[model samples]
Target: MISAAGLLVQQRALAGRDYRLIGHSGARAAFSLGRWRIALEVLLWAVLALVLAAPLLALVASSLVPAYGVPLNFNTISLSAYAEILFRQSITLTALKNSLILASAAALGLLTVTVPAAYLLTRRKGALANLIAILIEIPYALPGIVLAVAFILTFAAPLPVVGLSLYGTIWIILAAYFSSFLAVSLKPVLSAFLQMDPALEEAARLAGAGFFRRMRDVLLPLVAPAAGASVILVFLIAANELTVSALLWSAGTQTLGVAIFNLDDSGSSDLASALSVLVVILVIALMAALEYLAKHLPEGVLPWRN
Candidate 1:
């Protein structure tokens, strides 16, 4: 039989007390959250260090050791393995040269085709463009083994007109690299094209600038960073690529991937490890160079930067 007004007042008092209590505890809650965030960041960094640095350290250590089953330490380390790979191994040098050539060629080829193709795709919107995009993505989406099989089957026989066979040749490997990496090379350029304003081109057109002129003056400058990114990405992938190269390489055309596999397969694990260390060093150098170059690039050009 309490009065309604009294009940209302009591509820209000309870609410006010609850609000004051929350206000008092808010700082503690914030402090707890901050500690948790710091802890999480530290944990994440630790995991990354383990995942990335541990293997690299182990590789370097192994490469320095004289033989397999030998414990690696500063005192046990020697430069003999390095000297052997660099000076003595002819096939290693060949593999390195081939990898460099293939990677460089692939990067340039990818950029040449993808820049115009991406621009065309971005400019033209239709079912055809969509269909073509899907087609381009298919090879990249499929496993490397599948693509290798397809290439082998298609090129196993001599061409109908030229009577030329590309199977088990460097050309076949290059073709596979193109097919597998085309989509990757196109994505950044396409993204850049999509993000660009049409008004720039229209203004150039108003100035009587032709297609090539407009592309040179406006579009190329705008998308140069993306193009650079594409080149770097495609180069890295093609250089380090294994599965396709392993399947397609001939005796004289053996790439670094094939060389590495062959060395390990032949039970030259020490030599393989040594070669692998060099490859890792090369990869790290490239990535570091890219990172340094990114400062001069357009804001969104390097995907890993942001």
Candidate 2:
């Protein structure tokens, strides 16, 4: 129907137009895809936060519901359950104190050990340093229950000592708490340090600052926010820790977490729920404090921001 030369030229022109249309379509699709990806990422984070928060909010609301005959219908609500748990109990009060003391103490102990060690570990990378790093890893690599059992084996018995034992003591709690979370407390700050410029520290040291003075005035203040966040995380883990507490707790030294479990075993969800809600509140308060501290912290110190 057409000459070969004419058909070839016509076909090339048609092909050119088709390619241009395809290219434009692809460009438009890419723009749409980029926008969708960003929206999806934002949506995912928002949904995750909401999902994580929903159960806690529900527990708090349910705990505040009345336990007795004034059944709530469509919109009826009351605080009888909260009042009953909060005011009408005494163990919870003890639990409150016990949890606070144990958690805060454990956090303090972790920082005491971890901060210096973390700094030291990052400052040098040699044989002894590697050994220390590996040793810290030993606790984290094994299951927590295994470590709990190991502690009980070592400290609960007097194989090496004729009369010394730390069984069922606060020290045991602190030891487990320290061992369990030391790595987490160290890792973030260590990574931050590795990425951070060391010249700042060197300059300060050269300007006649002693080692302890430099740590106190320079590095500590600089990394304090990460340290604060680590403190809160370790404290929360310590406060809510049950495995070691259950295995190693003395009657006189039972933490609130274990105590709550004990109470609930006697079939008191109301009390357990109250404790759960309180723990949530305690963690929230700790997070709020960490956030407040972060707000005041200088940019170079907690550069990660979260």
Candidate 3:
């Protein structure tokens, strides 16, 4: 307590000294510090973005070159490398189909499960809501590999419970994604729900609308931003899903990512690089779209709702 009092006294003395000595000059110094901080922040962001993007740029340049070397120019760029994989075979097509299918399914599944889950969760309060929130966030704690192993073990049961065997199928992949992404998807949605007024929902119910009708009309329009954000997040995760899909994929169920790994394993550098570029381009497109959507989206009630 004495130390605290002494610190307080020191702060007051320093403030008094500054005010008496510098007078109005302190305001200029404070503004200078703020500008310095802003400049530093902008510079830091530029450096970080460059650091992350440098390797991807190198990959693109390398993939476009007919011969792989340490040249820092695009003079040797050729479309043949791109053409070789995209036009050369059917497996890339198959992989593309699989990736689209998997990502779409994962996004839809996340929407199906998390929307209702987030809405209903708003009904609870205090400890129950906190517990559910924690539970929803548990997936972020588990590594992808751990989740994959757990999923395989849990669903690999061969006892034929009611004629369902989830041991070896694409459904396992879908389930793994649903388990992993539901938490991230729910956070945005739940935040939206918390900001939304309960009266809108109550009005729907009072007007003789069923639960589905209310969700379809009232809640969904408000939560559309969150839903779109969740879909994009889930799709990106599903498209690049490597660890679980790699472990779980069998002979006939190889995703595009798994197929790329297979090409790398088989020393098919050309094909791997080609697919890598393709995947990168596709990701870029998706991210661009998401960014555009996020910017133009009608601000949802959640952010500044009363």
Candidate 4:
């Protein structure tokens, strides 16, 4: 009834359809599992995004509004609050300056203290080393308020030799920051040390490199990425910290945290909201920078990256 060529073409078409329709049961099950996992992953991401973004969006919206009770609308939105923070508030500027200075100092100081200490701890392991490590971490393990109180008590009195009281001073805050965050700053560097190859340092030592020379030429270069991470981490934490600074801040030494708290406490929620928005911007920028640097950094340097 049909030509041979037409019969052959019809048979080929049916074969193609059969091939498309047919698949192993295992393959179908795998595809279903893959789709399910993707859906779950997407759902998790959505929840996380909502949780993180809601408060930030609320703060930004509040900052844009002129008053606390005013709803965000076309007529209510204003930039006056931001202007007040930037132009009218000298206290805000002073707090920003002090926070920057203290954070920078703390980061540098932590790097100076933690790098060598990490190297020593990694190179030498003994009961004494373990004890020292625990002692160093003890303050950080304690609550920040406890450490703040301890600092206040310890430095409230004038030093016998210098006769200078550090309490109620920026120095006292710095001291507290150092004690509270030293362990935090040490973590990345210590991880770096654990991952580093000892043969490289040993090779340098055998080749007439002295302690300082080997450290400079061999060890520092390897550990630099982690050190950078430590500095940034400490800087961010110290800059935005409230708990320790709240207790230690004197009249002139009010930090950003104290400033924000004071602004809210004084019933100037609008100004506080504006300042908080700026702080959120700053934190976002720093995190973005860190994310950008994550590719260049060591694997474990960023705890959240993985």
Candidate 5:
């Protein structure tokens, strides 16, 4: 009995009502999802505070206390622990110096080797390069303890020509570090090279730039940021290194990690805690520096950034 116009009008009214319902449901679903995301973010922050911030606060507090078991209070707190580690303890100073030297040496030394090796590995692209890459990675892939043992076995004897022994010496530790961290130092430079256009180097070559000239002029400038990042990464890891240094360290060769362990073992827990706090501070400062440098470096050069 209805006219066609009236029927069309009725259908349009139903469609509008259905659309309103759908719009309301969608808004509700979006609101619910937003609430869940906020809740998850809050939970994540809470967990980080509980796990990371709490321990760090406790460590700082413990380091301030005069002794390991002393209760932390305004009256009981003192800077003696820090002073003792910084000025009073000769062993601690030695350990600090050794750690710095090793870290710097390892970082710079690895850069020289990794830069050329990474260049070759990146540009060559063949089965031989792949095999060499795998070989370089094997030392790092092995457990620190395993690699340390392997080094000890390999260098326990005196050299044939030099007639000098590396076992139980800093040289041996440096060698182990070279092997263990070769991969770490290589990765950033390799990433930089991979991202680079090959045409730039080719153009330089066509212009009669020799290998060293090209590397010094073209390649080095391009990869400097990544190389710096690699150096920092290697320095950070080597400075705090424990496992490899533990087995290789002899008299007067204690690294920071070894010093911390030795201090705790010898019942100088307060000193150990103080040293640990300093190490933490150093690490935080370096990370902040790296974060600031991240803006200038290429994407993905610093893994922690994004």
Candidate 6:
């Protein structure tokens, strides 16, 4: 009954209507998806605030209070606890010093061992290298408590030649640290080496560059960022180490972690909390510094970075 012209007009009208419906449906879907995304983001932040931020705030509040049972308020807040731990307490100062030394030494010591070892393992890739890599990782894979026990058994006896005992000394703790965190330090350096192009080293070698010169000039520069990252990571972990030191510490060898435990055990929770707050501050500062350096470093050098 319709003319051709009329049929075209009807078809165009229906097509326009369908286009409008499709657009409306698409808009609705987009809006729904955006709302869900926003909701999920909010939920994630809420969970982080509840789980992480709340506890940290509570810890800060606890550290500010003058006494353990006292409520934290403008009037009740005091820095006396911090002063007591920082100045009045010899034990705390000693622990802090010991922790700093141990952290620095462990970081530097591990770097010396891991850099060459990583290079060799990555370059050679033989059965011996594989076995050695496994050995390096074994101590780290073991639980801290188990590692501590093993170290105690191994070092309980005095040295054969020198007859020196390392059972209850800072040296033993350092040794344990070396054993446990070797893998931590090795991983980043090894990753760096693996990602490196061997041709650069070979080119230098062809140009009459000796081993030391090649490492100093070419390899070290390339892997320095990773090495630095390894140092920072190891230092952070070693500074707050607990398990190994708990078993191996002696009178003068108490570390920051042990000191905190001791303070709490002695009913000095305020002091303990104050010390913990300082440690938290230190850790945050270090993390922020590391994050800042992330841009300069290689892609996977820092673990927390992408």
lDDT of 3 at 57: 78
> In model 4, what is the error at residue 98, expressed in angstroms?
1.1
Question: What C-alpha lDDT does candidate 2 achieve relative to the native structure?
Answer: 0.69
RMSD of each: 14.8, 16.0, 11.0, 18.1, 16.3, 17.0
Clash count, predicted structure 1: 0
Q: Tens digit of lDDT per residue, candidate 3, span 1-306?
A: 343455445444644231112222233233456668988989988897799777777767777766556363566667676787888867788777877888888887788878888877777545565556556666655678888899899888854657776767777877887887777667567666766768889999999999889889998998888788778877876898788888777766678889889987886665677789889888879877677667534343123221
Q: How far is candidate 4 from the true structure (C-alpha RMSD, Å)?
A: 18.1
**If both were scored by lDDT, which would come out higher, candidate 2 or candidate 3?**
3
Q: List clashing residue pairs in candidate 5.
A: none
Alpha carbon deviation, residue 133, candidate 3 (Å): 3.2
Query: In candidate 2, which residue pairs clash?
Result: none
Could you tell me every candidate's TM-score relative to the true structure?
Answer: 0.85, 0.73, 0.75, 0.86, 0.87, 0.87
Superposed by TM-score, candidate 3 places the C-alpha of residue 260 at a distance from the truth, in angstroms, of 2.7
* lDDT per residue (tens digit) for residues 1-306 in model 2: 123344345444644231211122232233456668888988998897798777776666556554423344546565555576678767777666777788888777777787788788778766687667666766765566887898888788754756767887777767787787777666656654554468878988999999998898888887777677667767777788888778777766778778789877876655676678878787778767766876644333333353
Query: How do the residues 1-306 of candidate 1 rate in per-residue lDDT, one tens digit apiece?
Result: 233344445444643232211122233333456668888989999999899888878777777888777898778888788788889999999999989989989888989999999898878866677667766777787789888988999899998999999987788999999999998899778877866767778999999999999999999998888888788888888888899888889988888888888987987667788899988888878888778767655455566765
How far out, in Å, is residue 192 in model 4? Answer: 1.3
lDDT of 4 by residue, 194-239 (tens): 7776788999999999999999999999888888888888888888
| Reference-based TM-score, model 6 | 0.87
Model 2 quality (TM-score): 0.73
Q: Score candidate 3 by TM-score against the native.
A: 0.75
Tell me which residue pairs clash in candidate 1. none
Candidate 3: misplaced stretches above 4 Å? 1-46, 67-76, 126-129, 162-165, 205-210, 295-306
Error of 4 at 38 (Å): 5.3
Error of 3 at 232 (Å): 1.9
Q: Considering lDDT, which of the candidate structures 3 and 4 is the better prediction for this target?
A: 4
In angstroms, how far off is 58's CA in candidate 3? 1.0
Candidate 5 weakest ten by summed lDDT: 16-25
Which candidate model has the greater TM-score, 1 or 2? 1
Better of 3 and 5 by TM-score: 5
